[model samples]
Target: MILRRALWEGLLSLVEDAEDVPWILLGDYNAVIDNSEVCGRAADTSASMTEFRDFVTAAGLVHLPFKGCPYTWHNSSEGSRSLWKRLDRVLVNEAWLGAWPQSSYLSALPRTSDHSPLVVLGIVGAQEAKPFRFDNFLARQASFLQSVASVWRHPIHGTLMYGVVCKLKNLKSVFRSKRKEKGDLASNVRQAKEFLATAQALHEQHKEDIFLVLVKCCRMVYCAAVKMENMMLHQRAKLSWLKHGDQSSKVFFRKINSRRARQRVYQIYNSEGECLTEMHKVTDEFISVFQTLLGGVRRRRTIDLSWLRSDANYVLSTGEGECLILPVTEEEIKEAFFDISEESAPGPDGYTSLFYKAAWPVIGRDVCEAVKEFFVSGRLLKQINATTLTLIPKVQMPSQVSDYRPISCCNVIYKAITKVMVKRLQQVLHLIVDQSQNAFVPEIIADNIY
Candidate 1:
């Protein structure tokens, strides 16, 4: 155990030295992370599990999600004496995930040995361009609101949604120009530091009033540069708050890179099981699967709900149901906006809740009227409700579109509309939900259902 602990520490040191590049550790360590990885009557694995978990966590490695045989090793004993365990697996670092977000492994059946063979499941292709994403730090700028307001002043002759859409569209160019002006944050910090150092050097030699003023001005500029750089890093890294003592910029960049890498769809498998790297072909595969699944023909299977209806004792009254149909109030609209996290992912609009919250006072009337107009007229612009579908790999090596989970990122206004409706729905849920089904009900502990 002592020798193993020492080896873990040694490996940790090595990993830290080359943390910039993609790395993975794969082997049969003859130890399992938990009791689930072991089967049959074996000695207490508590100490071993703790040690292995500690090493993996401290080393900042993650288990590569795999498919195929769960038990990689067999004891090769008869009946009751037979034992199985997953002794072989793969572990990866953030750089590896950043390099191949779709990467996984397969545990093939053992042929000659008791241990199963493992194979890395992934294919690398050319990188694609990323769409524009709003930087959270930009919203904090003093000129941000002014820039937005300047463009928004233009009158767009259309529906309320169209007007808001046009205004947002104009603001995009403004924000882009702002980002270009900001340039590279890291470079800015470097230049600022260089200027400050020169000022300090001259100040030491002269010690005159002019040099003293120059040093202070340079110092202030350097501090501002550092603040902007750190803010940009924090937003990209998606950290809620940064610790004052820890100021590692590389960590933040790595997180942002890893997230971007993971979201890129490099390739997919066709029905014939051939790997495809072409982007258009992959797009067609996704469209075909989703179209068929969502609007496809199905078996004429009818479910028997007569027994359930008869046994059900809970149902909403007319007044209770009327509450749900009541018109959404402005308070509900504001509450929904406040409920969403400022840093949460944005849709095609490239605008997050932060923009809505920060600029509420300026655009509040326009937004409220827009939302209210939708409910009154029963019409909403497609752009306002446009969604961005992000695919997440479900299996070790997702070949087909079905193997990937699709998450839809809807526009904030559209989300806010639904959120207000959900708030109303939540109030009446307890009236209709059975006492036995505890999940999602107010004041009902889900564990009690167990």
Candidate 2:
């Protein structure tokens, strides 16, 4: 008979849920086989052992076989007063039994203790070791060589450029087979030879300075572009703040009630009017504080933020987190606004106002003129200094003198010449805009400010 009842409160619980995995419960039961299992046993009919058995049964556990020594506990009394007991047992469910039919249980006797050692035996599959490849060992050495070569080269260009050139050359075979002048590969090879010759000439004149200069200029331009992007991000964040900053004020005045509900409705209007006046003062304080922060302005006079938070709703919602929703009291509002005004009181650096300093310069002439016109119309600033400054890297320090390079340097010089020619075109456009600011305002600078 299965006698199921609570034992030790909720101590011995059953496992009702099972995941997709083989499970086995093999451990000592600390129970007896029966009353005959021990001669000097006390209360063999106790409910403790029955409760454990019921838990095992409810959990769908299957008891396994006992091999050599079944008795797990023995009383070591003098002579004929000794008794042996089966205190340990093994239990596993049907899932493990069906999965591994050859698996068996081993129960060994205790040497110096009462509990016995239990072991689960099964015929598990063998796993084979993978074979080593000579190419793998060579691959590691090749990677090490590649890393060392890259480090020695110092700012090495990636092999991807060669791959791109090769793909472009492949187009000669792909689109036009053996054409002479217009063939892609033929033209590319000719251009490559010319580049090599120019590089050789540049090397002969100046060894490394020209290349270093160009690289430094490129990096500087890249950094400037990055800075411009950061400024835009800051502007975006400020705009977003302007849009959502008034939400707290909206939350403040959502609930309103009369000061005295019992008085005649029309006669009690005076006190209600006073309450509303107090509320407006609170709202005004909120706006003044926020606007002052955005304006980056400071005042010598004290400003109270609490005069606006008059309603019980305002007081209750003033607490932190969700739990502190008790309407803010008049004292609380005074304390909060006092702290704000004290912290907000003026200081010296008033000249460093956000209003005066523009974050970036107007790049082109038309943009610059438009900006100047806007400020002039608004009476913000009298004049702005729009000077043409070339954006070059801080490194490289512009050089007027030529240096020696290998005969191969001519190829590099030719490339540099092409770049310089492009720069000259840009300079011409800039000069024309600066000279004829009124005419170029709509077309030139409007196309490119960045």
On lDDT, the leading prediction is 1
Instruction: Estimate the lDDT of model 2.
Output: 0.36
List the global CA lDDT of all models: 0.79, 0.36
Cα shift from native, residue 36, model 2 (Å) = 4.9
Clashes of each: 0, 41
TM-score result, candidate 2: 0.24
List model 2 lDDT by residue over 84-144, tens digit each. 7776666655455556634556667677776677776664434345221111111122243
Model 1 RMSD in Å is: 6.4
lDDT of 1 at 217: 98
Model 1 scores what on Cα lDDT?
0.79
Q: What's the residue-level lDDT of 304 in candidate 2?
A: 59
C-alpha RMSD values across all candidates: 6.4, 35.8
Residue-by-residue lDDT tens digits, candidate 1, 1-450? 778778778888988898768888987877888988888768435887898888886676767767678889999997888899988999888778867877868789999999999999785556677666777668888887787788877888988877887888878888888988999888888898999899999989988889889989998888877777777777677777665226766667655655554455656788888777677898888898887766656566676678776886876678997888787677878888888887677889888888888877767767877888887888889788778977877864566788889888888888888888788888988777766675768677755754
